[model samples]
Target: MADYLNNNAGMDWDDAIENDGQEFIILPEGDYNFTVTDFERGRFPGSAKMSPCNKATLTLQVKTEDGIASIRTDLILNRVVEFRISAFFRCIGQKKHGERLVMDWNKVVGSRGRAHFKPRTYTDRDGNERQANDVDRFYDYDEKNFPAEDDWMEITGDADDLPFN
Candidate 1:
């Protein structure tokens, strides 16, 4: 591993080239915990699936049995795919059921969530087959959305329960 860069001083390209690069990980189909490592906003040209629109590219660090897998996913920001945008916010606790929330991309990084990942096979433009990971669903694991049982009060209102309350 190379030493941390302080101010780009003493940087050597040949020396850095010796360091090994990250390995590609394709996990089996299952749910996994993932953190938003990076976020980028970009425009998407019109495709046959949908019209041109803005998109959010997310770099997720997914925890897998082998190790942490880096998966890059693009989220198209359109009403046609609004469910996916809502799911991401709900999973990260930014949005709750029956509530409205502003899309805050600033806080997206470092947010944690659970999602289902599946292996997908596709052909490259060069005519080569490749295997990659795809997100099946983003789950809502926000604790604040669901009140705990202990926080609930049974409305019997017994005299003895009054003291405990």
Candidate 2:
């Protein structure tokens, strides 16, 4: 194999991509159109606020002026997390008022609606103050009353034509 380390004669520290000191855009504190882009399972180490628990990481794509912003929310799988789960299902076009219904969580990936984002501030590892966006709640969006662009676009085409394929 060729020695790759010997080919960096013109390399400079200033030309390197800076991953640190990156700015995080905080969404304005308000309701915005959002979609459930992905889901993941994670574990939380023991903490003073609560015991270690399994959490469902729901990645949300919120519509913003610049395009879209990704925000993650961890829902601990415990008794206290029922309300959040229920609200999430309801936002995905599930009926809440009349009769009980079963929700297929797997099909919730393309669910879109209005999500309330709240501003949260915390100290970073370097003792620097940082701002983050938190999902407060989700609401059923009325397309008739307030029509907006659908965040998740459904592509009806051959699967083989996809770039990933």
Candidate 3:
């Protein structure tokens, strides 16, 4: 965080916050048992330049040989991408094949399943090469293959639980 601030001192403090040395695992490209830890509706830049759009953002916690790793995926809710949204629901044990879209997305949280990841390379604004483990696909989970709750990533803290100043 300090290094970033040093490199761009003109940047706004709000735009450049600290990572706080948080430890995270960058999972290798592969499939693993995962749980839906968080789900939310988020606004993101659309393909049309500055145009914004809403999407269902999912944070999956995958248990791997290294440790529990966090993987994020977005499902566009637009009519054109309904298939993607259905696929996401199927992976999370919600809707089945040929099933209509009629379920609470909130119920998706805490659901466990298999997630497939693939390594993708992209150039950042700084023209530096970076690699990301992106979700390639998701597999339906069998109850027998489910990991114990303890095996999944745990959220240790919440801002609401913190003492106020």
Candidate 4:
């Protein structure tokens, strides 16, 4: 495998690929490249403070000769304060295709923290209204009227994409 390191010694990654089996690979701290494949439109369930600005980029590549592939994701932890965040990709259909990347965050306040999700609303060009999805909820968080410092935040979803068989 090629050394997954950048010129600056930062860990580089691609997030758009997936392996056959379930496994986790720890990555060193650094900047990485990612692409957006699919995402879930609901609040990520966990102990990380989440903002509408939170987004994940996935990068994918495949080794034609060996049939090997490499993938990575960069989780930009851009919260107002220190907090814990957890995320994973859950496939929706039984065919084991179409995955939903779910993330959860818990706000860290001094010593205590609170669980929160993005506020949601719906609007139609012709005047129709509808409920927002998880992605929409995150977008709403990005667009703020008052624009509080804490309002605009982001986090990177960086991980190694392990390919199966």
Alpha carbon lDDT of each predicted model = 0.80, 0.71, 0.73, 0.28
Q: Pull out the clashing pairs in model 1.
A: none
Candidates sorted on lDDT, descending = 1, 3, 2, 4
- Deviating ranges (above 4 Å) for candidate 4: 1-20, 44-165
TM-score for predicted model 2 compared with the true structure: 0.67
lDDT of 4: 0.28
lDDT of 3 by residue, 1-165 (tens): 233346555656579675575356777787777777778788867776334668888888776667567778888767677777777778878878788978588698888777688877899999999876688887764566674555543456887885872
Instruction: Estimate, for each residue in 28-48, the C-alpha lDDT of model 1 and write its tens digit.
Output: 998877778788899989788
Give candidate 1's whole-model lDDT.
0.80
Candidate 2, position 117, lDDT: 95
TM-score to native of every candidate shown:
0.75, 0.67, 0.70, 0.19
If both were scored by lDDT, which would come out higher, candidate 1 or candidate 3? 1
**Model 2 poorest ten-residue lDDT run:** 1-10
TM-score of 4: 0.19
Q: Quote the lDDT for 151 in model 1.
A: 23
Candidate 4 lDDT by residue in tens digits, 1-165: 122323225334864543375232222222222112222223323355545454443333212234322343334445642122222221111112243323432211111111122223578887886432122111111122223343212433544533431
Error of 3 at 94 (Å): 0.8
* Model 4, position 134: C-alpha lDDT score: 21
Tens digit of per-residue lDDT, candidate 2, span 1-165: 012235425756668663363245689899887777777778867577678887788888775676567788887766556677767776766657444666576776766767789989999999999888899887754565235654345577999989998
Q: Distance from true position, residue 40, model 3, in Å?
A: 2.1
